[model samples]
Target chain A: MIPVEYMSVILMIVFGFVGMARKFPRELGATVAYTAMLFALAVFGERLGRIVYGLLYRGNPEAAPDLALVQWFVILAFIGAWVVMVYAGQTLSFAGKWPPNAVTGLVFDMLIGLFNGWIVVWTAWQYTHRLGYPQQALGWFVPPLSERASRWVALAPLELIPDGQEPWVLGGFLAFLVFLRVVR
Target chain B: MILSLQHELNKLAFAVLRPVLGGPNPAITPPTGASTGAGVGIDGQVVATAIPMLGADLSAATLVLVGLAAAIGFVRGVRREAITLMVAAAASLIVGWMWPAVASLVNRLWRMFHFAVIERGILAENPMAAWGEAQASAPLLPLGGDAAAWQIGFFVFGLLILGYGATRYVAAPPPKARGIRGFSVLLERVVGAMVGALTGILVSRFVLPRLVPNAQVALLGPGTSLYDRLAPYAPTTILGIVLLLILFGVTGIGGGKPRQKMYQ
Candidate 1:
């Protein structure tokens, strides 16, 4: 229900604390999953959005979904699915020679949590902005975004990655993560 | 490497801030010096396009950079980081609080020493001349050739390193025990890093604001650069980091304890 700008601003710190609590394993798992989701969305989100919108239109003849909004909602669903999977007993759990203690591991975890928070909060912003900052969505009342919130949104992290290069960038990042995992 | 990354980020921030602040876009020509709150540099060239944006960036970046110290500290060892943090905080607070007085004293001493060396030129020729030469080329740094800031930075850090060395060797000398050199040593290093980082943050928090202007602190509010947005997160993030150290230390997990000496 909070404004995306306000929520996104604080989310990273919240995630940092969450990282401290979750330690390494769960946090890394979530990070990997989120990064993968970002990659998948970058690669196929538009195509999938068009397809889904077309199908919904064909099936009901009056669905009338905004394609961008649908895609963002789809992204939200994907995020939700991955969120469940990550928390669902270490589906993408990382394992190996663990760190020396909880605190040391938690440092990395906190960083990872902050990283995830940046992505997740941005996705939330995407959906909310696409919807034109309404006071409600579905049956829930959401807080309205301020006039200046959109300007601040332009400064959020990860949005500056050049367009038409997201797949390659995210793909390379995924590859690097795998390389790091293999080596270390 | 880090500076370059920060530069790229700054460029991006500047692009957004340009329109927001009503500054001339670098891409196109403006109608001749449209008073965009820009400043002229040392070489009589236009320096920052918009000083407030840069100020905000600087404030945010400084805070983030200081927070990064905590990350380094955690990776090293909490205890070591703590000691380092204490030493650094002490040194920086001293330097920041007493800089005016210290600068005057130093100038007086240098004047007296310079006069003495000149008077005793036959005995103190090369050493004094060499020292003078070393002081001459005080190169420019990030905050627009603010050599005073650099001097303060170096002075505080030098004191902390010396303080840390004293604590390590004099206050708590390590016993020469083989095969026990493990995570404890590692923990010591990480703790050192954490302390160093926290100290940097402390300096940034307590001392940096005084050095910067109101415009810089304005970004610390909200609706600014990414760094600015996250600037306020320092307290919670630091709390999380410190609490993790304490919680994990108490739990005795992560092999925090050194491996028992098999050889001994």
Candidate 2:
């Protein structure tokens, strides 16, 4: 039987092609933007839910609902808030007479595409090795130069932070960059 | 050569930006005695070691690059695009953070199916027993339990939010021009092939060696000629190249302009 590890390597290549075929940078940017918006929504929704729940219960544990029920309520709140925020952001971003709209879209799209492509390759790398394939069965497929290139690619972000520091430091810096990019 | 460049860059950066960002410190290193195997460093507590100067240098270089890119975008009046790129970067960070939980959930679900099949006499006898043995051998999360349930719930919720948000906000913008521009088509093919080849090598060298160390897939095995070492990578590299070519062919081409109906 063809080894599963080999199959996974094939799958990774297919994913890479699909990513490029789909216009890697654009799709990648969109994925990242959407994911970030979703995360923001989730965080906002959870906070809102907590506030609402607190008001309803008035800090009384005895009056609180079951754990599952509370969890469900929180999830619902998260979804509701996320939907509202996404729509509002979209409308705001597109409605303006912004000259940079097209350019911004293109640049971001390209950046995301590159990032996503790397992610696809990285995840595939992890899987083929971790999933119990015989040594070198899948590893032999990757070229030497590519391996070095991937490491460098991976290191770009890793180099930004002091070792052992929270990743958010970099995230915050990037956010600042976005703000600068948008404000002008 | 790259390392030296990085070192010089870091020195310059630290001298200039230390007042604002902070003084340069050593980069974090893995605990000295920890094995480089799966589940070795998952726990939050990693014994600290002297940070690599190279890491610091790289960090400085990255900062400079980001600043340069932002400056160029500002000059080009692509403010919106720069903003979008920033947002995308932030979003990537969020996704990266959540990926582990999501992957763990998927693995558990797959294991459940595997277990069920084994129980049904598909693979072996005493499937649960075999599973227990496997679980003990691999340093993975539990297949199913309370923690698993919570993880599944979180994954489902996250997916739902992402799906809804994507449909509403992340729809692909309409293409402006039609048919593949010749230059762009060529560019795509060349870049795609290069990227594909690199990815093939990365998969085999860095990722596989770390995860499946026992597998005899070292890129530069002791005494092996470079040609022999690279022989196995040929198929994967070709596959990558071909896939990229197809991708470029299909997506690079655009529909013709309304006035010109020649290439329909």
Candidate 3:
């Protein structure tokens, strides 16, 4: 009932804009409009999430027990992706051209978008399934000897998550690629 | 962020309203920067929505009227036109603050006396019901209250960004470099003020309603509110140079002259 998949639909639009922005930065007035829309969308998503949770669980998930963990991961994941998508999409759109030629550019953009979408969905699923449990303790979940611990704990994988706005920079790069393609 | 935003809003209110109160109009010369006014009515709505909010408070209201009066004062600065500005500002302040309720009442009266005319139009069958429904669908946020404050914050942030941008890309040497004379300077200022006023009217009447329809809900005539304001809003044929100078290009109209003496 929460319609967790709603996030996917939003991503689709974000990527769609990225694809379009590559070809039409000035015409679309997209660089700013898209960013503004994404910001507005984030607020809307939170409100929608609350509404969905209220309808599904008959109570606000933010205030409920055993649901807080799910809420945290789900909400954070959505926010993280939401921000990243804008940065990524904008980069791709603004660049407005493809490498070497149009065919190569379009193909490369589609491939990157596809992969980005996959990674986002996969990470979301992991969070939804494993981290979704409300009572699951954080640090103890992975044993010291276990593979999860060695990679996630010992390697400290979360550190690899780039700092704020880095993804947006990447998004700008992607936009440039699109711009090159469309402008040519 | 909130404090800076609020301060900038206050400053802009001062800049914009200084004209209305019979003050010298320190006109905003538009620059020929990229015309980004294509369809997205953000700027239009931002400026249009600002008026009602400014009118909500006495000081802020005075600032907007003063800004307008400043614009009207043209080459003459605020010092020369104090009396005219005060009367104009006071009148506009009263009108702006009271107009919403007054307009609402008038609209209600029009509906009553002109019921036949109202019904004969597109919504002839159930005009009142449709009007009620439209009112019901108004934005959840209150007009000219907290939402307006948030909007003002955003507007301030935008202006800051725009100001920084202007400093970077749009600043140009004064018209002295272009070799214009006394008559040309006067013409430029007059034309610029007229252009800005026209832009204000067109934006207030059209483009603004579309981008932030709900924000300008109180302004639209009844027939106008039936749909999105964005769809119909279009840029006026403001002269290219004036528009450019207003947004980004600076002509230094007030440059290097002895400040005119205040009216004795």
**Model 3 chain A weakest 10-residue run by lDDT:** A152-161
Off by over 4 Å in 2: A1-49, A59-63, A67-184, B1-198, B201-264
Give the top-scoring candidate (lDDT).
1
Is candidate 1 or 2 superior in lDDT?
Answer: 1
The local lDDT score (0 to 100) that residue A68 gets in candidate 3 is 51
Ten-residue segment with the worst summed lDDT in candidate 3 chain B? B245-254
Ranking by DockQ: 2, 1, 3
Per-residue lDDT tens digits for candidate 2, residues B1-264, read 333443344345444544533422233323566432223245765643322222121223233434444443332222222333334343334333454665576667666655556445236677668676444443233333223223333433443354223422553222212244565545443533343333233223322222211223433433334436665565445435434432333233333332212111
Residue B191 accuracy (lDDT) in model 3: 39
What DockQ does candidate 3 score? 0.01
Query: What are the per-residue Cα lDDT tens digits for candidate 3 across B1-264?
Result: 444544455556445544533332122212346332233355654332232222121222323333453375344311222222223333334334454554456555555544445345345677777565444443422334333344433333433344222322333322344465775556445533443333234223222222222222222222232223522322122123323332211122123321222111
Off by over 4 Å in 3: A1-63, A70-92, A95-103, A122-158, A162-184, B1-264
| Candidate 2 lDDT, A80-165, residue by residue in tens | 45434533443212111211244333433343344433333333333233222223333544333344434333322233224444
TM-score of 1: 0.49
Q: What is the C-alpha RMSD, rounded to one decimal, of candidate 2?
A: 23.9
